[model samples]
Target: AQSVAQPEDQVNVAEGNPLTVKCTYSVSGNPYLFWYVQYPNRGLQFLLKYITGDNLVKGSYGFEAEFNKSQTSFHLKKPSALVSDSALYFCAVSQRGTNAGKSTFGDGTTLTVKP
Candidate 1:
């Protein structure tokens, strides 16, 4: 079974400061990782993913993530955070080419960016 973890339940950041939402995974085989963001009353929106090549993967809305095989981590990052960036973030993982669209998701991390 594949499992993902977001160590922090809540992340508080200042507007314009660098922000990071940590994620780590455990899988039997090579993992396909994904990050998602959700706003109030809204469904999750894909943020980024790590499948093959380039450890640094960029995604929508100035967000990026680094896949560290050695650490088994795929933490989400943004150089500068905006107040609008405040949202719930999720980290997910699944065995490559096995689960298809199915994945194990983290409990979620609430990001709050204050002015």
Candidate 2:
């Protein structure tokens, strides 16, 4: 089974500060990892993904994540955060080439960027 974990229910960061959102995964085979952000009452928006290349993958809105196969982790990062960056973030995982349309999502982590 493929699954994702976001240990923290919420993350608080100040504007202009860097932020990190932790994530971990479990899969039977090579994993397709993804990060998505959700605004209030809205659907998820794709942030970034780690499929093949460099373990360090950059994504939308100045966000990035490192795919660590040995650790089974894909932790999201941002060099600097904005108040607008506050949102619900999710870490998702699916087996490579296995109809990723049905990827499993972690319990979302709410990011609060205080101005």
Candidate 3:
């Protein structure tokens, strides 16, 4: 079985500061990792993904993540935080040969950026 864990319930950051949302995962084989963001009353939007190659993957809205195979972790990072960037973040994973549409998502972490 494949699953993801987000240890933090909420992350608070000041505007212009760096922000990070942690995530860890387990899968039967090589994993397909992804990050998504959701705004109030909106659908989930794709942020970035790590399919293969390049441990460091960049995504929408100036966000990026590092894929660590040994640690089985994929942590989302942003160089500078913005109030607009505050939203619900999710980490998900699926096995290489499984249905991509069926990826397991974490509980989700809410990011709050203060002015």
Candidate 4:
């Protein structure tokens, strides 16, 4: 079965420090990976995605992720954290079969940045 696991429920970090939210996935064949952020009660905003090509993919909000095919991991990273960056982060995967458009999301990881 294809699934994503975000090990950390929440991560607390000081503003300006580098931050990372881990994600690992299991699936058959290649997967379309995505990262989204949701603010209080709002819909998720797309952050980044690893479809194909380079291992490091950059996206909005100064965030980037490395796609590790061997370990089957796609971990989100940022060089510097911000207080405003604190929100719920979700890792999603879309399959290549008939359910391509459908995305399965991880439980979510709440990032708390202290100023």
CA lDDT of every candidate: 0.94, 0.95, 0.97, 0.93
Give a tens-digit lDDT track for model 2, residues 2-110: 7899999999999999999999999998899999999999999999999898999999999999999999999999999999999999999998778857799999999
Better of 1 and 3 by TM-score: 3
> Using Cα atoms with residue i matched to residue i, what is each candidate's TM-score against the true structure?
0.97, 0.96, 0.98, 0.96
Judge candidate 1 against the unseen true structure and give its global Cα lDDT, from 0 to 1: 0.94
Best by TM-score: 3
Candidate 3 residue lDDT tens string, 7-103: 9999999999999999999998889999999999999999999999999999999999999999999999999999999999999999988787889
Q: Residue 12: error of model 2 in Å?
A: 0.2
Residues 1-115 of candidate 1: C-alpha lDDT, one tens digit per residue:
7888899999999999999999999998788999999999999999989989999999999999999999999999999999999999999998977856789999999999999
The candidate scoring highest on lDDT is: 3
Poorest 10 consecutive residues of model 3 by lDDT? 93-102
Score candidate 1 by TM-score against the native.
0.97
lDDT of 2: 0.95
Q: Please give the RMSD of candidate 3 to the true structure.
A: 0.6
lDDT tens digits, residues 49-81, model 4? Answer: 999999999999899999999998999999999
Candidate 1, pairs of clashing residues = none
Full candidate order by TM-score, most accurate first: 3, 1, 2, 4
